[model samples]
Target: MEKKYPRLQIAKYVAADYFSAMVSWILFYTFRKKIIVAPLYDSVGQDLNDPTLIMGIVIIPLFWLLIYYLSGEYHNIYKKSRLQELGRTIFITTLGVIIIFFILILDDTIISYKNYYQSFLFLWGVHFSLTYLPRLIFTTRTIHKLHNHIIGFPTLIIGSDEQALQLYNDLQKKPKSAGNQIVGFVTINGGPKTPLSNHIPHLGNLNNLIETINNQKIEEVIIAIEPSEREKIQQILTKTKATNVMIKAIPDLLNILSGSVKMSSLFGVPLIELSHELMPAWQENVKRVMDVVLSSVALVVLSPFLLVLAIGVKLSSKGPVIYSHERVGRFGKLFNIYKFRSMYTDAEINGPALSSKNDPRVTPFGRMMRKMRFDELPQFYNVLKGDMSIVGPRPERQYYIQQIVDKAPYYLLLFKVRPGITSWGQVKFGYAENVEEMIERLNYDIIYLENMSIYIDLKIMIYTIKTIMEASGK
Candidate 1:
């Protein structure tokens, strides 16, 4: 039931951080007033109600909170590791202190630079100590509750053989709980013949997984199917890939030998947890922030350029300046993708088709626009609208998507994230002329998705710019 109270627990962390930040700032200010610049306070010691102090008390805590949030410290509050928390707190606090020093305290009227260093070190120490202490306390208490089974994720076990039974017993009887509350079990090959049915109730088969997960409020899924049933793993994974729950598979001898097994506790069942997310939480947050900011700025600054592009397309083509076409977006949701019209009217009257290098339907002006990526500039509006990202797997139309999925079932994984204006595929392989080339280009996008980080996005963008300059894309 504690899992159901996530917001309440999250509020506790935020509240603790807010007050700790406030107290740390107050203490730092007091030290500055009393020791660093004692002459300014007069012989009688000054009133503590200065406007600057009041402002710091109000705004500085918010500043620290913002720092913590952007550093990814406040996310997944219940799943925090104490050791990791300590390390992250120290790192983020140090960074925040440095930023604040440069921005605020560096301009202070200090007698010497030595005093500035002292003030900075003192403030950092106080802030780090105060902030980390409460976090450690809260995290420790939460971990204690988790270990004692007071707070646990609602996990579903998928398998009904001896392996699954043993895994269930091992996790259930462990000295320290792995925080998986086995709500029930699901059998991939039917539950009647399996020994697990004698113990836990079988919820349903893989056919009803999404519904079962939703109805049961499942948070995690443990895949412990036997080696003989390994073929079912792909089907299981495909079915569960779209669900938000964490997916973990039981490791085999090869996995153990390859060092794939990771145990959080001494007796906890080892699991090969699927990589939970593509990028660090902070990078994901920062990417979204950049998307909004950059798209907004581009829309404003490139207004004149967009206007000219629109006029050119209108004059050169017998169609609307902007083309709106349906494309599958994140989680298979369809959205209208906007682009400058790069083709004449009735270019796709036969059906949806990929453009070729020498397609006559593409106007000369349109080809120039494609070479310069001016056709995609309007997608900044799509990014601003949250229908697309600045960088991701380029979305495919349903007609092409069906063909791609038929050739490579894993293409469905691309739907997990928002489509981008420029992708690793587009940068590396350019526009695919056919389904076969599209499938070949799919590998790079998959690589990009697997190792998605800001660095990769920047690298793809650099390549895209080079491609545009070279006029190399098909």
Candidate 2:
């Protein structure tokens, strides 16, 4: 089996973002101390020993991160446009600088109001330039790689008729034109034969579109069905909307001529909109960076605690210190999720079983760990691994997921995002004692999915902390 690459690629991008943000923060802090604030001096220099200055180094980066996240700068790393990213970065950085100035620098003992203004502008320039310059360099390289066909989204055409063939030819002839490199084509109906089979292999017929997309690592889908196939197109669109792939359809000539199509000249080819991006690209990048930095910090800061828990689990339970179990993740891929072993080694000897409040399989330490959510510390690694997020719907085994989907078809929507260590459902409802409670919690998870914003995520995190502190979790 070809290893699924999307999650891994996303993880890599997030890791890059974490490092980039760290560098930016360091640069900004250095600039603030040496250039921006240091100039506010008489013959006798201002006191350098103020704790606020030291604290600013820590607080500024956090504020920047929160601002970047709330502005939706960190949502989807893979599906970002360079122009969109730059616009968002500039906007968020400007806003963040203003906030920082008002909160920290404005009350400084400046020589004049002009000096204050100069200091604010200098800080903004240093931070924005430091941050955006690296991001632009990275994004530009990615775009160049994409345009040169060295790196491209794995795209599949969904129609096999004349239109699909035309699209395939257009894309193949101008590889750099579309940001997508066609891996192959999948036929939508038993209609006209496609002529591009010589260049692109036919993966399958229409009945297996979903399976083909999953198996082929397809990142984008172009629906080339004729206007007459409205019903079929609707069905395909409805089914595919749940998947995290970009969906586009060729508009009729009339619509194109009437200016319904928005075109962009990247490398000299007019590309049209497939669908509105789910999240802005820069926000996606920000989210990844946050995930990586927070996860890494949590792992390191909590290492002593994690070690103690591992030892406790080893002594308390007849099992390995860590438990690795298969759980469904983004786009329904299975990954071995790690957690501190919180149950007996043979807890699942009777096969998969959902834990209840008084399940005999849970050890005393395990129960405490579950209550405080200490068992989940190991999954910070999962967040770093990109198998999960720090915030999102909790992942479940296929056994439970299938059961949930039977009652709620929309359960699959949760798979569109990486499962989280703590979710709105986990925070609000705690662990489900049975399938019924699981379904009930699924409702909140679905709500979180629909109203997914950084603000909502922060709320979930706050509630999660409260739940953990109160030991209110089941």
Candidate that scores best on lDDT: 1
Q: What does candidate 1 score on TM?
A: 0.82
Segments in model 2 whose C-alpha atoms lie over 4 Å from true places: 1-152, 166-176, 191-199, 206-211, 214-217, 227-244, 252-317, 402-409, 433-440, 469-472
lDDT by residue for model 2 over 58-170, one digit each (tens)? 56556666665556555555446779877877787788777777876677665557867767676666666667776776667666666666666788887776777777666
Residue 337 local lDDT, model 1: 92
Q: How does each model score on TM-score? A: 0.82, 0.66
The TM-score between candidate 2 and the true structure equals 0.66
Poorest stretch of ten by lDDT in candidate 1? 253-262
- The local distance difference test score of each candidate is 0.83, 0.72
Per-model root-mean-square deviation over C-alphas? 3.9, 7.1
Best-fitting candidate, measured by TM-score? 1
